[model samples]
Target chain A: MSSQSVVFIGAGNVATHLAKGFYQAGVDILQIINRHFDKAKNLADQVDAQPADDLNSLMKDADVYVVAVQDDAVQNIVKDLSLPRGTLVHTSGTVPLSQLSNAAPESGVFYPLQTFRADQELDLTQAPICLEASSSETYQQLKALASTISNQIHPVDSEQRKTIHIAAVFLNNFTNHMLACAEELLSKHNMDFDLLRPLLEETWQKVRHHKPSDVQTGPAMRNDRQVITEHLDRLKNEPELQAVYRVLTESIQRKYS
Target chain B: MSSQSVVFIGAGNVATHLAKGFYQAGVDILQIINRHFDKAKNLADQVDAQPADDLNSLMKDADVYVVAVQDDAVQNIVKDLSLPRGTLVHTSGTVPLSQLSNAAPESGVFYPLQTFRADQELDLTQAPICLEASSSETYQQLKALASTISNQIHPVDSEQRKTIHIAAVFLNNFTNHMLACAEELLSKHNMDFDLLRPLLEETWQKVRHHKPSDVQTGPAMRNDRQVITEHLDRLKNEPELQAVYRVLTESIQRKYS
Candidate 1:
């Protein structure tokens, strides 16, 4: 079990990170497969695995075949995949584990619950990996593989994993958009975005310890209509941003008032 | 002067953190003035300063008098404040330095550009302190005083400071509300909030180094209508959340599509 080999079926951010993590953990990586040969080769070269452009060329003997392609392509890839003596898993948050039933007798999910950027370095060793499998045996194998790379391994079902994904949309995607909106507003005013950087850092630091409700503070939280009105007036030019500002402000006021 | 004495006119989060920062830097804290004597006495005890519930009891000979009261109270407080030998400064992001003109010939702003929680420990030494003043001498003195506690001090004017405050509301207040929304969504489904904590940490970590536009990822970023539709359907029971989901999803689509 310790010598279990893994093959990845994508060369994107999720694949690049997980492949590197498995490589660092002394696990044997068999192949890196992508529709684009160069992307496959680039990630494969880094991990000393064979790079393949065709799903037909995948090794049938690997202990695990991880389909890490786009969400729309996951079902098709799994449909074409057939592991001779191994488990198959797709690294997706939204895709259910049952989607892999046509791929292999043993199927599961191996979703790393963190946003990955190909150009940035991510320490997958500390990241939470969500696991779901078709069978108890496959679950144990998936858990073991996940344990090699992460200490925060979670056994989540399809419903729970989807719940986490939606929550992540709010935490990462929506949060980043808020900053992006701020950046746009600052850029329009010719103010340096760096002015808000330290405050951003502090806001995240506070959330790490306290609940969001406990740490909430601002004109909206304090029900300071004057400041809120001024901010709304300031944003009157950009209706989209103004709408966002108004809605978020109203939401905060509703909760606090 | 290195031995200059200061007085604080409020005992709220901003005042408590800044007064402690200056006190730790060995600046003499002469008095803590607040209408609520207990709060003033509590903060004053921490900084080894005298507590006074009366504005008339303020030490006029101090090198600086910091009016760190609420935004609406700042103008009225400055109107009543008459420092005989010290500069008058208000710790506010939106309040103009002109509001303090009648308080003293030398007036300025000493705004720490970070969110503060009174119960939590904040290292003001690393926080950005935005300074604005009525005169060059007062600006230099404020800068010197600010430098004692913070390495990241910038001289931002009233207009720029107000812009920063609006941006802070987005970066801190709006971001926290996003997390609150996620928490509410998860709680409704009997899911643990801790599941998304790691993803939240990584989101902030990525923003520290990369621009938000570059690191943005989600169903909306890819225009995955299926996932987006699914998420919206999941939130259909909560109209407010559903509205947030749609607006944010549309915002992301507008940016990346």
Candidate 2:
């Protein structure tokens, strides 16, 4: 019997990270398909796998097909890719795994519960691979594949996967956005941005165990009108940042002593 | 002729941190005075110093007197101290060492360029000490004393110190407010706040060594209209945060490729 092969149905950032992880872990990446032929070929080249421009033409005996595409494209790709019985999966955060039809013999989820970027060096070991399967045997196969790359694996259905995804958005995406805002503000003033690194690192470390509200310190929280007014004056047309300050100060004061 | 004893004119966070730092560095803190003597005495006890409610008594026979009071109180406290040949220093970001007047033997600044909390573990060795003085001898003394506690010391004059302080505000205090806002928005949505930690940490890391513009990432920079709109909608009531997002997005887009 041939070793089980996994197929990637998209070549986005998620696809790149997941495929690279799978390839490095010695799993067979049977085929890669993308709307853009060149992009698919490029990603496949990195993993020593062949590319398929047409989903239907990808030799379809793979044990798993990871539909790691956009949220809008998941269903369309699944409908188009006439996969082997129960051998379809989608890696999405917000999308429910059950959206894939039951007619597909082995549909499931292999959503990595972490942010993925093409250039970023993500330690897959820290990723909690959330897996859900239509059948127990498929579930075990997904688990086995996930275990090769990640130390953390969670047996989660669509509902639980979404809750985890929501939590991740709060933890990763929005937080990064906040940092980006800080960077922009700091640069405007010709300051050593590094001055903030220790503080940001400290802030994150504190949050690992303590509540966010407890660690908040600044003029607004202390009701230091002078500092607050100075900051507000600096904000100028950036009323949104001021509103954020007001709302956050109010919220923090309410919840904390 | 007797040991160079100093007096502290405020018992606030900075005063307490500085008093503790001075005591650890083997400097003599002869007396501590405050509007609230209990607070002054509490700090004095920590540093093995005496407490004085009377301004004349605190400054009498002192080799140096430090006014670590509020922004507006520094000048008044220095004027009241009337030290005869004793050094007078003010620990403030905005206020100048010259603000203490030439009536004293020497007037200087010993501003530690880091935020201090009453209970937080402050590694003074890592903190920056911005020292300024009315005379060269006084500068050397303050620098030597600061060097005992911190490796990082700068002989920044009043104007330079003020500019650095402004920069500090942009990087530390303002950035912290942005973080607090991130926490508030995420918490209001019933999201786990831990998600923001890693992203914020990474941003700080990148900005430390590289230009913020070079490392900028997010929906705004990418011109991902869809995601930006979604996030903006999510922050509907948070006009301040929304303004922050808009202003920052514009700045990032303008600054980066």
Candidate 3:
């Protein structure tokens, strides 16, 4: 709607969401390029944009170039990109904004700090979009572009963004593994995994408003050795789970102690 | 309303919620008893029931006696209680139902599977109320009392209930600690913890429907050594967080590998 045409360099989950978000915001999606032509075409078709597998014939007149590839692939893709005049951005939490300096005169970061699933539809309007740029002008441009989809825009540097990324690993990856462990334990006992849902729901409800440490309850937090020991004995058959249980118990105990 | 009178044996978080829930379901709460008379009276005031600090005048005519005490205290409380009639049930996940056998002729387990906070208002209507009893008559009584508040009732033995309790530690306690870790990391960097809420929201949304292992995304899941190493290096100053990060990362890597 603002006459700022954009091209996405990857058609992954992040790119798919961003492209659809932009398209719905009335921005002209110039192209969608991926290493796999099918993937590019698949996403581009939804956004009503051209699809290209090769980087050689990239759109030269776009207002912005979004490099949404994997963190490892971003450097090579940006290095090889030959944009005549457009601000380049990478939607990554870890990668620095400077990585796109060679791709365009203007570079920035537009990281939406949420886990994306290829099959699941995510409304990005409320997700925190952490931004960093090489210049003030580029920052403003990136901010304006991000405003189209999300209002939770934050200006974070590379170091701070890396910290957030690491924190996210703890919040998302590790917490999810904990749930997986619960599922495995329940399934082994022939108990319904669905039985754990209300507890899970209540836990997150508390998490939304209270500090995890303040609301923390369990044998570990209470330092109940009897319960802790009994739980350890129950998990003795699964050494891997026992190790995880022991470490987490020790960590919680140490934190509170 | 069904002429089944109830008496609560503790005024802790579990007792507070259960007592209130039963009162709302039109069940008669004859007395609320706790070691602390003030705590007992505080909850009794809400349900229009009598409060007592001692077990000397426990209502013998009440159809159900609910022991909502700590794991270690259950045996002693049940041992000391002089009940003339009615089913005696303990709301504990770890304590075996047999512990109540000496307290009453009709003994049963009426454990509500949830982490209760005294301040929070919880709807027990959907939470799993696990039941185990010495006789079919006791089971039916507990089930009817449980059904007055919750539709989710399960008949689980001590061993299975213990397994669920252990699993709950992983799901709620450890998972909450992970969020605490994230809060600490973010706070040290002067970042608002609220920024992490959307990610937390989306993570739980995915968790509600999918197997956690399937929806997992992070360096550990992918075994991205570079990112993992970078993150570990960042946590060099915080040894506790570093240990947790390393253990969780290794666990995820081992799980996938």
DockQ, all models? 0.69, 0.23, 0.81
Q: Candidate 2 overall Cα lDDT vs. reference?
A: 0.68
- Give RMSD (Å) of candidate 3 vs. truth: 1.9
Worst 10 residues of 2 chain B by lDDT: B196-205
Instruction: Give me the displacement of residue A257 in model 2, in angstroms.
Output: 11
Segments of candidate 1 deviating more than 4 angstroms = A81-85, B1-3, B46-48, B82-85
Clashing residue pairs in candidate 3 (N, C-alpha, C atoms within 3 angstroms):
none
Categorize the docking of model 3: high
Residue A218 in candidate 1, Cα distance off native in Å: 1.4
Clashes of 3: 0
**Highest DockQ against the true fold, candidate:** 3
How well does each candidate superpose onto the true structure, as a TM-score? Answer: 0.92, 0.76, 0.95
Q: Which portions of model 3 miss their true places by more than 4 Å? A: none
lDDT of 2 by residue, B59-94 (tens): 478777888887777766766556667788888877
Cα lDDT, model 2, residue B96: 62
